[model samples]
Target: MALKETRRPSIFWLMAWVCFGLLGGSVKFRVAHPERIPERGAFVIAPNHYSEIDPVIVGMMLYRLGRIPRFLTKASLFKIPVVGWFLRRSGQVPVERAGSAAAKGPSPLAAAREIARAERIVVVYPEGTLTRDPDMWPMRGKNGAARIALEQGIPVIPVAHWGTQALMGRYAKKINLLRRHPIDFAIGKPVDLSEFEGKPIDQHLLADATEKIMGAITAELEKLRGDKAPAHRWDPSLHGQSETGRIEP
Candidate 1:
């Protein structure tokens, strides 16, 4: 007989979100504005990739809040001996990092579709890889998240995270909760790309939208952390215009 699967129970997700929100009280978590997204519907929770544990923490937050989020995880991870079993049972999608097949794999897309059909939330790390943002900011990303949003007609909510760097730098592979860092998460309003409707949904548009959303996230993050990001083109002081003015289709 096949081995039994280890799925993430609804109760577990609910409890996880609640526990995290409550736990966040001890730390310093600001929801920013929770009214941005509807409580129910198919939406994308796109957060920057910082710590490997970021996904779990964000997932726990949503789960505790009574929302189920599907994550796009690396395919290689599924090859691991026993851990892969747990991932599959938990309904996580394994993503190949290499070729076209990896980008548009049928199985993962199907899983994404199913999650949307269920009217649940999905978490995605758009950066494709951990940040190379010298400043630990989000790097340019692959637009799989945007494509998913367009195809499914779901809103993409940008989520910015801070304090994780203090918890664990880019080089650190584990969490140090005992350090009691003030982890920050700011969720931007749902981005509506309906204007792109009927047009060919190409990577260019998808990538552009993803960048815009991430940019919004970063701006919010900067405000919360009271830090200054590098003066890139997005920096208004250098351009005399807001980064939002530079978004491309």
Candidate 2:
């Protein structure tokens, strides 16, 4: 089934203008294989997390591809004044992480269902947060995206991007606008989860699905950067690093 092309909400336009004002002239953005995104379907847009500005770059890429991005954002951000209002008006979903007081409300999967019902694109950072990998490679991912894909029978489209980290450091507060940064976005084909579909959703199945999704994302990144990824992905728990953000050495 195809999703109808609807006009973007006012908030989206406002954000677009903001992104343009911030990134338009300073960043040279490039998107490869954007056609990989389904023209009309409810699909999970799983992308590798690299920098704080990654969402803006990825969102702009999708906007260029003619799709309004619906992100699965952290719930706490919904409490802020202007940002919260914009998020709600823009149709972004709030996801309550474990241990957060906001976790008492609806599950993220419920938000996924709402996105699917609307047959819109929902951008999910499968790594949950930014990559803790020392080399900026994609690390172990959480299972929310995989569960939603398997449960809803939707495609998990993997996307990879580079250069956002260069423009803004992982945890840096300043944006470097002196030089034009080249941001490259590559979209891979939909992950094949046919074998796991219709089966009981479990840890093992979710793990396997996540591996495939992350692997696909890494491969696309390799193509964009012309480099090979490490043999094994980094796991924060094993390295004794917090999973929320960058790991400080």
Candidate 3:
């Protein structure tokens, strides 16, 4: 069941559909639990981050699930000339790498507000960037996704995926198309935030909600990888690693 018309322009919708479609054909996708995607209304699709190509892979998966996905991408990526122009025009939201709305929008509340206004499936990386874990397991999450869902009264859908790293390794500059990498995606039920409902939206509440979202994603990932995640989630601060860049230990 495809979603109703997207808020993005027809041209961009077609462009992204074609671009990601070609990329999608290059890789073999094994998806589980596609039914978890919401058929109606606006919702957040939170996924684990591991590779540079994840956005393309996840966007294609969501589109196939019948929702045209809009991403919460870093502001810096939106500054790269033609790429930036396309990002802005394609209806993607520009967010500060520091985890706030971009300066152009100028309000902490502005990004989520615009996303809610669009009423489309918005993909937010709870970690805010590629995973810093040595094993590429999910690390501690940023509160952006939770903030959007809680403030906008929308649900956050957790998704776990694997094999993008094989298609293009973490921090790799080139995608290997010589062989078809089998990528897997598993969508989980929307995180239950009923307990946090009506609470003061503070750092603590947002962190807790973000963990809930991450946990849901990790759980689905375990199904694909057939193993358990580490008992402790990787903490960038504890490891003295930068949150937004490649940090070599």
For each candidate, give its TM-score against the true structure. 0.75, 0.94, 0.90
Model 1 CA deviation exceeding 4 Å by range: 1-28, 99-110, 231-249
RMSD of 1: 8.3
| Clashing residue pairs in candidate 2 (N, C-alpha, C atoms within 3 angstroms) | none
lDDT of 2 by residue, 152-236 (tens): 8889999999998878988788989888999888989999989898889999999999999999999999998899999999999
Q: Please list the C-alpha lDDT of all candidates, in the order they appear.
A: 0.65, 0.85, 0.82
Best by lDDT: 2
lDDT of candidate 1 over 1-249, digit per residue (tens): 111111335444444555565555444444666555456677888887756567766775565445656786778788999768767766677866556766665455566777788877778777655665546666666676777788988888888877766655665656565646676677787776777767898877777777776676677678767887665523233534332222211
lDDT of 3 by residue, 45-107 (tens): 889999988998898777777777787766778889888987877778776645444445434
lDDT of 3: 0.82
lDDT-better candidate, 1 vs 3: 3
Name the regions of candidate 2 deviating beyond 4 angstroms: 1-9
